[model samples]
Target: MRNRSHIHQLFEALAPKTEQKEKMLQNILVQSRNEKIRHRGFAPVKRLRSAVLAAVLMAGLTTTAFAAAYMGLDEAFLKFLNPVNHEQAQYLSNGAYVVDKQVTNENGTLTIKQVIGDSNLTYILMDFSAPEGTVLDAARYRFLDNDITTRQNFQSVGFKALDDGNRSDNKISLVMSVMTRNSIAGQKVHLRLKDLQAADPLPGIFETIIPGTWETEFKLDFKDYSTLYPVNQNITMYGYEAVLKSISVSPISITLKVDSSYLEEINEAAGELKEIGDNKHLDNFPITINYADGTSETTAIFSGLYLSEHISEQILMIKTFENVINDKEIASIVFFDKEIPIQTGR
Candidate 1:
């Protein structure tokens, strides 16, 4: 077995490099990471939000994998996601695993396109369509129980439509993401959507759009492209002691776990954050990712700020990048005022 060394190993594999291999990765990274860091902040134990991840690639970083566009993930980002950028597309193209699993019923069809994620955040993109004659109504038709099943006590996070996939009347694209305390890198997830339906004329009811259920399962193999780094260091938060546990970065999103064990005062502040949805209390400490160049990206403009779950040792914070990123481009991660350097694994 390869040795797992601290102050180092996190940079291991994730695109292992020789002089030539490093050149290939540099070709990819040189073309990425100009966009902002991400949105979404520390939230309640496991509250799900229906949000879209809008990021893509540039012209130079295109690879054969991207050319293939195996399961439309490329298309999904280009057309479906709101705004596209040059971050992470190349890295994702080489990493995002493809499923292409499809299940059809009389009413419509469902196809599992692709997935890219780790333990904290896992995103699965899928396509759904109504049958020939009719079209799908977003307000009307939906999977009554479109959910991911995880054996490792993972929390089920809700999903939302990435966009009008295919831009067809009968079709819509969906992205389902979930959260967990454990490392789910290399874990298989069973995705099952049961009872497709539309809202009934009655206010609180539903009618069947598709008679049967649609289910597909796949494994997340993102560990090779995205690596989780353990910090195990303590930091001063609000003049209190808190542990900066671990951080894992991927092309699509960033997840960091900060541990403030058994702090009721922190919980009180978290309650206010959940209620107002802003960065006021306990937002003093900032996170920034430095690149190979002198410039760096900070957590300024986020998608959402959720301060939550101080009771548990976990502060579930997950965010996505505007572009794809690589470990080679990152020099160090700055949390609070402490700096954790990332070795190039050369």
Candidate 2:
């Protein structure tokens, strides 16, 4: 009943009939507990009613109350980011360096929850809890390191922030990955967060902006905790021949690297393969990861195509579980359920 008033107001503001609106509200409340909403066992509303409520629901509209959804760090992360592989979550629970410390300012509080470091990537997970009705658009948030000019090896950085599915209007979680040419182990890296702007704006109402700065220094723990499976094999798919370079399983991620020459050949033969409508820069081929435990995950969210013009290398990088699974050996890479053997020419 935390946001009972706001929830009721949201429905009242919609143009649906009073009776239909009440019924929808009742259903949403019954389905969503603790701010976690799932479309299950709920009847679809009429198109007209849905149209009236669509924008509001997308704008963080909810059925009220804070459920046990985001009670803990792991639970909170899972609630918002399910597309992330389970290995990363397992590593956070096992080997990652975690300091559940928080920094507070007039704007709000920021916490660095956990971190995973390896030879190839440095991953950091953090949470920001601010005043109610806050909007921290991850696209606008920036990361700054003033001493980067003095550092070595570390290069590009990327981040993904999720707002617990609009379940809670006050808290947001972020996962940031920094890729380096070499290991970041034993190096004290100073990271500066600049221009973190939190906005609470109501169109045609009132607007507010809170700006703040946060800084932190941490060192990567160096250890050989990953298993590198040597797989230099050639496989044919969709009239194209390619080589599976290797699969690297670490506490932070599962990376599958494929040579690019084959892709280039296929692309050239296909005749300037223009971006498929709305599916830009992605190969239509389906790639899946199968584990010995009989579990598999399929999605383009964990995959990327890297084309290096200088080296004429087109490496297909499939990003899987962030952590390594010791009990489950990778069975094979499957394309459309067809197994591609991991040939070791030993």
Give a tens-digit lDDT track for model 1, residues 1-346. Answer: 1222320222222223588778987875654332112223523311222111112333333564543443224456433232222233344445566777888877678888877665566667787877776766544445678667776664656455654534448787777666555556677778778876666332536677667788767777554445678898987655566787887765555667788874555555434322123322333335788988777887654532233475476665665544444556778888775788876532
Regions of candidate 1 where Cα sits further than 4 Å from its true position: 1-74, 77-88, 137-142, 164-168, 195-212, 221-224, 274-286, 300-312, 321-328, 344-346
Residue 127 miss distance in model 2 (angstroms): 2.5
Candidates' TM-scores? Answer: 0.61, 0.52
Error of 1 at 223 (Å): 4.8
Worst 10 residues of 2 by lDDT: 64-73
**Total clashing pairs for each candidate:** 7, 7
Instruction: Give the per-residue lDDT of model 2 (tens digit) for 37-87.
Output: 343344464444456566667654443211111122244433322322344
The most accurate candidate by TM-score is 1
